[model samples]
Target: MANNDDKSQSKNKPFFEVQKVENEDGLGDIFFGVDDETTKFPDYVVDFKDEIEYFISVIQLLYGDTKSESLYKKYYERLFTIADLAFNSPQEKVKLAERSLHKLKSELTTSVGQRIRTKLLMDYLKLAIWPSIIAIIIVLLGDSVLTCVLAFLGKGTENIYISSLGLISIAAMAGGWISTATETRNLAFVDIVSVINNQRGILVRLIFINLFSIFAAILMIAGFLKINIGGLDSLQIVDSPTVALAFGFALGFLDKVFVDRVEAKLSKTEAK
Candidate 1:
């Protein structure tokens, strides 16, 4: 009867328990229960053991003896508890736990300095790529659209192919992309989190930059805005395709400056 009782108790035992074992090097290792054939854990659970151990070591390296050390210690403890549950869970339950662990790991790692910087570059790339593609499409179709518009207005379509508007608009887009990329690259890691959080705003800004550039190009073409290119012997942007494109690029590149000035003026008016 006693032998049967002992077997029942062993059968009901949890698969793993967390214990700290000190090695000869005086460093502690996380031991997940005993290594025996009776403990049949899935391969993913076993793999996660190594990952969690490594993560703990990284936390120690990053936050050790710092003001945030205690807070991170609490985080580690919480993760350890979840891992403990996962190790003892059934296969179906383990999968859910695995996803939770991965999410936690991602969130923690994203805040790391190097990771944040990489994310900043990636975010800027996403912001730049879409607008550039749209600009290219517009450029390719611009001549057809110009010809149609001129025909509708009873104007000559003969010089539509020579029009500088499309090229200038695309140049403006390129300038905006460069300007935004420069700003993103110069951001400190600490500020990157806020930038990442405001992805929608950044995307809108890119769109605005493209539209503003197009509008400025139109104004120049209509003689509402004039720019005299230096060393071009009094050649105005409207008269010279190459000069017009350059002017559009400058307008796009200085978009941030223009935006800031306008905002400053608005703020002053509001203060009064």
Candidate 2:
């Protein structure tokens, strides 16, 4: 009688539980539980002794093993499914499909959904950055060298002094474009995009830079023509308009650099 009583008591003890997966019936079964927890980030998912142990720990957390797991799996599957459909669809249907997917994402409130969205955003940024990167490379190498070469060649022309100054101005314009291109490309990275775009609130600045470049190019062409029409030996610094233009441009550039540095510092303070 005592042995039977002891056996009954043991059976009634609370069982440590893992996950409830479908055994044979459409319902789940709880395997024996052993506790395991993870602290690492997504790039490194945690390893477990067994499925039962893993599920048990997950179940223990808020929205843990049960609802959270199901929610994540469902959202992740949905996100990928929608993405696949969007990609395979015709161009005309792409925007519509993306809207539909976005709606589906909005319905989700779980951590899993948030993570999936973050990944999607990163992918989008990677695509955006490529063009800006290419532009930067082209401006840095192509424009920089060409402007300098053109300016040096201007020395042999009739207005040698003026042409040289014009060439230097072109180089400065190239430098500004190179910086803009670089900044835009940097914005493609997920970590820095917001900061880059935020400070870019002044869209007019880009227009001004482009206009400056155009003006500089025009000046260089005019200076070259003037030099070829006159004799290089007769070229005088006092008569050169390029000198004033180059000086003004250089001063403006320095001012811009100073302002940008100050703004960056303020932004950092605000962030903190």
Candidate 3:
């Protein structure tokens, strides 16, 4: 009876209680290249047993085995380099490598939907910022500008005031469009077609920025001249409507020309 009891107890001894549990899912043989009758280590993946063991320990500390395994597979081309750095490098460096992997994953080939959303959001910003604001302001201040212009520029200042607002929008929008074109020169030639198709959104933002910036500049100049800008009672902005708009338009066009001349002059001076 005792012999039978002893045999039963031996059979009941759990495999886990006898030894440290191994990864029996075949990853040990495949990833680490363990040698046995049932498995063979490939020449490429073989590392020292101690090195493999230590690497697994360190990585497991950072992430679960499943995550680490997935990352190893995904970044297989850079697997050893990443693993080596993570094991040997300082904590900060290791963290950086991990973050780089995540960034690559996140930004990897943006979807069509993502591109459209990004482009649209940028366009909406353009419309909201200066273009829309200036448009509304120009419409509201039409009568005031007419009154100011008629007093100064003589007959039919209202016509001139209306014209000035239109000019501001055109100049601002054109400048912004050109700037956007320059910005996209680096995109692949093939990609530029798609960019062009979606450019309506981007064009809107630039228009707004240019429009508002020029308007603000006009306001500042007007403030200097002590012009009464409609609804803008502050010390800054238009002394007279037509003059302010004309000055801003000239500046919007001439600024780039002036900058180029200055650069050329400086280059000649430096060459001498």
Greater TM-score among 1 and 3 belongs to 1
Candidate 3 residue lDDT tens string, 1-272: 99998777644332111112235542322133212432443332233333334444333332335755764444333434544443333321344445554443333223233454456446645654665566667757766877886788766543334444544555545554445445554453234345645555455445544555455554444443232335443242234545544444444445464345445755877899
Backbone clashes for every candidate come to 0, 5, 5
Put down candidate 1 lDDT per residue, 1-272, tens digits, no spaces.
99998887666555566665543533344567754746476587567776667666655554555576575666577667666666654322456666777776666655564554566556656767766666566657867887899999999887453245556666776676566566655454234445555454666666677677666666556654444546641135546767767866776788776556546755877899
> What order do candidates take by TM-score, descending?
1, 3, 2
Sorted on lDDT, highest at the top, how do the candidates line up? 1, 3, 2
User: Candidate 2: misplaced stretches above 4 Å?
Assistant: 1-175, 182-191, 195-202, 207-245, 248-253, 258-272
Q: What value of lDDT does candidate 1 attain over all alpha carbons?
A: 0.62
> Scored by Cα lDDT, where does model 2 land?
0.40
Measured with C-alpha atoms, the lDDT of residue 135 in candidate 3 is: 62
**Per-residue error at 269 for model 1, in Å?**
17
- Model 3's number of clashes is 5
Ten-residue region with minimum lDDT total, candidate 3: 13-22
Between candidates 2 and 3, the TM-score winner: 3
lDDT of 2 by residue, 32-88 (tens): 332353222222111211322333223233233454666545544554444434333
Best by lDDT: 1
